[model samples]
Target: MSSSFERYQKRRLISSYFSVVLSIALVLFLLGLLGLLVLNAKKVSDHFKEQVVLTIYLKDTAKEVEVKQMEKSLAMADYVKSIEYVSKEQAAESMKAENGEDFMEFLGFNPLLNSIDVHIKADYVTEEQLKLIADETTSKSFVDEVRYDNDLVTLMNNNVKKISFWILVISGLFTVIAVLLINSSIRLSVYSKRFTIKTMQMVGATKKFIRRPFVWKSVRLGIIGAVVALIGMAVVLYYIDKTFPELEFLKNQILIASLFLGVFAMGIVITWISTFIATQRFLNLKTDQLYY
Candidate 1:
């Protein structure tokens, strides 16, 4: 009977340990996911921002040399990421390919004006920056007009801001939830050992002495759980990189290392603090109250 009772206690201990580690690991995984989202949000925003194209239409009288010079000058602009000059002939060819109709041949002359397509940098996609670009381009002698989709630019900027706000709110909420969950799990695991804590107290053991072993145990669990969570996060990131190769640009080695360190620190700190607080509560409880 004694041997059976010992086996029962051993099984209970193992179960508690497993429960605590699993709970902590799950929480850490969620936190890591939130971190990755926050890290990549800006890169995604920039990609969309840079897609806004500004079309600069050149005058019919503008010579090729003048247009080329303007293109060279615009290439040096701080706001411009890239510029592609579309000659009237190239524009006519593109339109012909689009509809299988040779409008230039029917008209006897290409009516399409030469134009430069400017891809602005993400930092210069704002309304004011674009207005300045338009005004400057329009002032040039060879430029007939500057055109872009104002509605699309406005929509993209607004959507980016909204997405960033929601991401922040979600990340904050998950962090709080993770802390509460990990704390509760550690508390329940410690509750199972309440009798041991009380027995040690009755034997005149110091609180520090009683807590030392449990603290070390919690620390070990924290490290193990963190390692597991980090592995899970790495696997997820690997899958994401494979599916969306463009997202790889956002994944810097230093940034990922920092994220891993953050998870490790969170695991260790949350587990240790939760275990300490839970142990204190049980240590203060009287033998009669232990039942409750």
Candidate 2:
């Protein structure tokens, strides 16, 4: 009977440790997910901006050589992300497909002008920057007209700012919630050892001496939990990258390393603080309060 009771107690201890580690890992996983969203926000914004293109139409008398030279010059611009040349034939083909009409056949000749589709960098997607770019492109002798949807560009910029602000707010709230959850989890885990802490204090043990082992234990558990959380995050990231190869652009080695370190540090700091406070409470409590 004595041996069986001892084995049961040992099992309970193991279960307690397992419970604390898993709880911490779960909280950390949530925090890591939020961090990933915040970090990838810029990449998402850039992807949308790259979809906006500025069209520069060429004059009817513009030679192919002159168009190519203009395209080369536009490609060299600092704000240009990419540029594609669309010949008159390609534009007509696209329009015919869209409208289901052979307009060139009806008109005897292709009325569409050759144009360059220029995608500006996200940083230069603003209306003022686009106007400046259009002005510069229109000044070229071979260019007949430069066009973009000014209202659409302004609307997209405004929406991006609003979306970014909301995302930041949500991320901040989640971080605070995670900290509180971690704190409560650590406190409960330390609470289970309150009796032992009280007995040590009654035996003339200094507060610092009583705290050393509990603090170290918490630190070790925190490290284990953090490492497990990071492993889970890596697995999630791997599948995400595999499914959406474009997302690979958002993964920076340095940034990922820093994120993992941030999680690890947070785990250690929260566990230490929570354990210290809980242990201090037990140390100062009257023996009668231990029952509560």
Candidate 3:
């Protein structure tokens, strides 16, 4: 009968520890998912920013050789992501297709100018930088005008700023929630062993001696829980990669690795701190007060 009771208590203790680790894993996994999105926010923003094109129209007197050289030079520019030259004929045809209007029949001549569309890099998409680019391009002798939708650029940058602000707010709130959840779970796990802690102190065990084993146990559980969370995060990333290949999220391996290491260290640190505090509480309580 005594052996049976001992086995049951042993099983219960093991189950309690398992529950603590599982809770930590779930919380950390959620935190990690949020981190993944935060890390990829810049990439997503850049994709949209690079979509805005700056069109530079050439003077009608410009020679074909000069235009080709200009296109090559623009293509090699650090700020240019891509460049495409549209001849006067191609521009007219595109307009005709869009509105079903023949420029030659309506106006006797095609007034559309030959232009080069330049997609600038993400970092140069700001209003000030764009103005500089347009002014420089227009100052060229062979360039007639440089044009882009300034209003649209302004709208995009403003929207990106708002979105980033909201994301940061959400990430901060979620982090605090994650910490509270992990701390609560660790405290509960320690509460179950409160009597054991008091008994050790009653037996003249020093605080350090009493804490060493439990602290080590907390560290081990923290590591195991973090590993489980990382595995969950890996599965999620794999699914995201397969489902949304265009996002190219996995390309930034360094950031993802840093997130993984950060989560692991956070788990251990939080667990260790929570366990220490919880154990310290029981150690300080008088024996008679423990019943309350």
Candidate 4:
């Protein structure tokens, strides 16, 4: 009977340790998911920004020299990323490719106009900057009009802003919720060892002395959980990259690795802090309070 009792106690201690580790791992996993969302958000925003193009149409009567001069001016613009010159012939060919056989037959003559397609840097694709670019282009003598989807640009910018704002808000909220959840879990785990803590207290152990072992144990658990979370995050990112190679920007190996490391560090920090606080709280609790 004495041997059986000792075995049972050993099993219970092992189970309790495993439970603490598992709970910390789960919290780390949640933190990794949040980090992944933030990394991908930036990738998505850059993809949209890259699609914003500004088109400059040449005046019908404008001479070739004048058109070339206008194109040079646009190419020199600070916001311009690259300038693609679409001559009358190239424009006609592009229209033909899109419209098929019926397009040329219906038009009788090539109605395509000469234009310069400008790809602007992502940061400059804002309402105010776009309007300024348009005003400057139209002021040129050879430029008939600056053509871009004004409404679409405005809408895209507004949507990007809203998305960014919400991402930040959601991330912050999730972080707070995660901290609270992990703190509660740690507190409960420590409470299960209340008898051991009380025994140490009765033996005249200093609070700091009693805390040292628990604090070191918590730190080890945090590190293990962080490592597991990082591995899971890396697997997810690998699959995403394989499935959508077009999103190469998201797969920036160095940046992604750095972000993964940072998240892992953050997970360890959060776990340690929460566990320390929870243990401290339980240590300060009255004996009667430990019953609850």
Best by lDDT: 3
Query: 206-229 in candidate 3: lDDT tens per residue?
Result: 999998888889889989999999
TM-score sort, best first: 2, 1, 3, 4
What candidate 1 gets wrong by more than 4 Å, as runs, is: 1-8, 88-111, 247-251
* TM of each candidate vs. truth: 0.88, 0.88, 0.81, 0.80
Question: Which is better, 1 or 3, measured by lDDT?
Answer: 3
Evaluate model 3: give its lDDT.
0.91
Off by over 4 Å in 4: 1-19, 32-46, 96-101, 237-262, 286-289
Task: Give RMSD to native, each candidate.
Answer: 2.6, 2.4, 3.6, 3.5
Task: Mark the 10 consecutive residues where model 4 has the least summed lDDT.
Answer: 244-253
Stretches of candidate 2 above 4 Å error?
95-109, 247-251
Distance from true location, Cα of 93 in model 1, Å: 5.4
In model 4, pairs of residues that clash are none
Better of 2 and 4 by TM-score: 2
What overall lDDT goes with each candidate model? 0.90, 0.88, 0.91, 0.77
Clashing pairs in 1: none
Going through the candidates in the order shown, the clash numbers are: 0, 0, 0, 0
Better of 1 and 4 by TM-score: 1
Error of 1 at 129 (Å): 1.0
**Which pairs of residues collide in model 3?**
none
User: What overall lDDT, based on C-alpha atoms, would model 2 receive against the true structure?
Assistant: 0.88
